[model samples]
Target: MRRRVLNGEICKRAACREHDMHWKTLERILTFTEPPGYRLSQPRGSKVDPFLPIIKEILESDKKVHRKQRHTAQRIFERLRDEHGYNCGLTIVADAVQRLRQQNKEVFLPLSHPAGEAQVDFGFADVLLNGELTKVALFVMTLPLSDAICIQGFPRECTESFQEGHVRAFEFFGGVPTRISYDNSKVAVGKIVGNREREVTKEFLRLKSHYLYEDHFCLVRRPNEKGHVERLLDFARRSFLVPIPRVESLEELNEELLRCCTKDLRRRLRGKSVPKQELLNEEQQRFLSIPEEQFEAKRLQTVHANSLSLIRFDRNSYSVPIFQSLQDTASASMRSR
Candidate 1:
C-alpha cells in the first residue's frame, strides 16, 4: 500500500483513508516535524479555573495531614460548593488535585541544614549512675555539618528526660541550634499520622516554643534522615562510653559527657580543613540564645483524692482544695519529681 501511494497511485486503501488521524499528526509522522509541545489554553469563562487556587491551597495543606484524614476530591468539591459557592463537577476537582500532586512531587527538593541546625536521637546504654550498674536511655544530639555531638544519660526516655537533654545540650554548647531534627520518639511526638506530619507531645511543644527552636522529624524507620545522630549513637557506644567512668550521680556523668564532647571537636572530620571543634566553635555563635527562664520539663501525673480530699502520691499525702472533688477533677494531672 505504501509503494502504490508513493508511485502516484490513486491509493484506494479505504481502511487508511477512513482513519481519524488529523493532518498535523500525519504531517509530523510523514515529514518528521516535532509535535506541538504546549497544552491548549483553558477556554475563557470556564468556572473550573476560578476555584483552582482554592484547590491548590487545600492540596498543599493536605500534605501535612494524614492520608486517611485528607479530604477526597469529591469531598473538596462538596466543600467548595457549600463554602465557596462552587458549581463544578467532581471530575474537575479530582483531575486538578491529581495533577497538582504530581507537580508537587516533581518540584520537591532535598533540604539543606545550615550551620545552626542539628539532629537528635536517643539510645540505651548501661552505666553506673550511682555506684550501681544500671541501663539508661542516652540522648544524642549532633551538629551534622561539623560532626560535633552532645550525649546525655537519663533513667527513662520520657518527656522530662527529653526536655532536660535539650536544655543541657544547648547549655553545653552555650547556645541552641536554630532547628533540630529528630526521630518520631514518643517524648517528642504525640502521634505520627502520615508522611512527615506529626502531632508533637505537649511537653515537647512547650519546650520548642520556649527555646524558640524549630523541630523536624525523620520518617519512621529511615534513620538516614537524621544520619548524624544515628552515627553519634554508635560512636557514643564505642568511644564515649568506653571504660565506663563511675560517677557519683547521673548529673556528674552528663557533665563528663559534655566535656568529652568538647574534646571530640579537637579531631577533624572527613573533607574538613580544620578540626571539628573549631568549626563547631565558629558555628555556635550563630545558634539562638538560651531563654532567661528555662522550661520546666515535668510529667503530668493524675492523682485521686481520698475520703478526706487528700491525694496520695509516692506514699505522700497531699491535701487537695476542699472545693475541688476527685470526681470533678478526674481528668486533671500534674507534674512532679
Candidate 2:
C-alpha cells in the first residue's frame, strides 16, 4: 500500500519510503536507530558428554555391593572395564561417580512443611551485658511460613542447651513446629554412614521421641540446606540484638528477642502483606501440633556431700529430716512434692 511521507511525498512500501526520505527528516521521524555489526556467536568448547546410564549403573552397583572395603572406585572401575566390558575411561568414570555422589548428597524433593515446620540452628553473637563483654551462642528457630523467629542465648552449644532451647522456643512461640530441620551438629548427628544412614545422638533422639516429631539433618558440610534458620539468625542479630546494645539479664534479652520476633519482624511486607503470625497459625493447622504437655525440661543432677543432709531443687536445698525412715513412704512423699 502507498504511504504518505513527512515531506508530503507518497511511497508504496515503508522501506522504500525510508530509502527515498531525507536522512535528517528520517532521523526526526525515527526515535532510534539500530547499531551496526551485531553478530551472534555460538558457544565453543569440548562438551563432556554425560554418561548418565553408566553413572546410574555404577551408583546402583555401589549401593547393592554392601561390602565396605570392596566397593572402592578403583575396584569398581576395574570390574566395569574388565567384567562388564564397559569402554568408558577411568577418569570419566571417576568424574561420573563424583557427580552422582554429589547429586545423591541431598535427596531434593518437594517438601511441604505444615504451618508448624520449623528449623533450629545456633549462631554466635557478641553482647554487652551489665558492663561485661559476653560471647553468647544464640539458639534460633525459624518458622519458614511466618518468618517468625524464636531466639535464646546460651553460654555454649551442647545437647542440653539445644534441648533447653527447644523448650523455650516452643513456650515463646506458644506452640511447637511439627518437624525441625537440623544441621549435622554433634548434638544431633553422631555419624553419617554411606550418605543415607545417620547415627543421631542419644539426647536428640530422646528429644525427638518426647516431642513426637520428625527431625531432619542437612547433608554433611552443606549449611545452605538449612538456609532459613541461618537467615533468621542474621535477622535476629540485626533487628533484635544490634539495636539493643545493653541488656540487664539473659532473661530480659530473651524477652526482648521474643517481642522483636513476634511484633516487629513478624509483620507482613508491602508487597506480600500477610502477617507472619497469621501465616504461622494457618501453618500450625496443617503442620504437626505440640504434645498436650510440654516436654520435661532437663536439669543437671549432682550428688553432693552436704553437712545439713538435704536435696537441692533450684539454689535452695530442703532438709529431709535425718531421722526419717528411708523407705517407700519417704520416696513417695519426695516424688509427690
Candidate 3:
C-alpha cells in the first residue's frame, strides 16, 4: 500500500484505510525486504495418531538398544500388526518412526585419537572348519587415526577369547596401545553403576594394569564413539573373510588371516599416497613395550549344555551354532561335570 501511494497510484489516506494499517505501520512494511509466509490448508493429522503414544514408547525403548540392534520400520510394523493390532500401512509408520529417530539422535564432532590410542571390537564371519561350515568370531583392533588394524579369529567371544585377542593383538602390533576404546560388553565390564562409573571385571582390569593402558567405554547403545573399527568390521568380513576359506581349525585359519593382513599393508588405500605398511610400522613404534610377564586374562566356570543345545554359563545360556559340536563337546563337559 505504501509503495503504491509513493508511486502516485493512490491517495495516502485511501491506501492506509484500504489495507487497515496506520501510516507508520505502512511505512515500516514498505521498508522490509521480504514478507513472512503463512502456511495454508487444514491442521495436519496422522493415521498413526491413535497409536502415537505407543510409537513414543517404542522410540524411547529403542534408545536403550545399540543402533545396529534397534528395531527397523518393517520390524516395528510387524510388531504393530501382530501385537498391537495396528491397521495402518507400512509407509506411514516408517515415516513417523524415521522422524522420531531423527529427533532422538544426537550428533557429535568428528573424533581424533592420538597415535597410540586404539579401539577394540568383535565381528562375526562364516568360514569352513575342516570342510565343515562354521561361524567364527573375529576380534579387531585399530589405531583410529592411521587406520592400522590387527585382526584375529576366536571360536567364541568368551572371556578367555576376549583376553587372548588382546594379547595376540599386542603381539602382532609389537607393542601395547596406550589407550583402548571398547563397548561395555560383559567380557570387559561386569556392571554399570551411575555417575559415569563402570565396574570392570578383574581379568580385564588385570590386563589393563599389566599393559599400563587405559580403557574407555562408550555410552550405552552408542558404538559411534568407537566407529572407526565398527566400519572396518564390515570391510574385514567382506574383503578378508569372503568365500569362507577352508581350514583345519581356528588356529590354522587365524595364521592364514594374519598373513593376509600383513600382505594387505603393502597396498595403498583410497585417498592415501603412503601404503598402510609404512604407516603401520610408524604407528607400532608409538605403542608401549610389551609387559615382561604374560598376563592371565581368563576366567573358568563350569557350564552345561541344555536340552536345546545351548550352553549355560554363569546363569546365561548361549546358543550353539553346530548341533554335532553340541553333542560331541557337551558329552566331554557332562562327563567332567
Global CA lDDT of candidate 1, please?
0.80
CA lDDT of every candidate: 0.80, 0.72, 0.84
Candidate 3 wrongly placed segments (more than 4 Å): 1-105, 300-337
- Backbone atom clashes (below 3 Å) for every candidate: 1, 1, 0
The regions of model 1 sitting more than 4 angstroms off are: 1-112, 306-337
TM-score each candidate.
Answer: 0.58, 0.56, 0.63
Query: Which candidate wins on lDDT?
Result: 3
In terms of TM-score, the best-performing candidate is 3
Ranking by TM-score: 3, 1, 2
Per-residue C-alpha lDDT of model 1 across residues 50-147, encoded as one tens digit per residue = 88899888988887988899878888889999999987588877888788778877443455668999988889988876788888889888887778
The better-scoring model by lDDT among 1 and 3 is: 3
Candidate 2 clash figure, as a count: 1
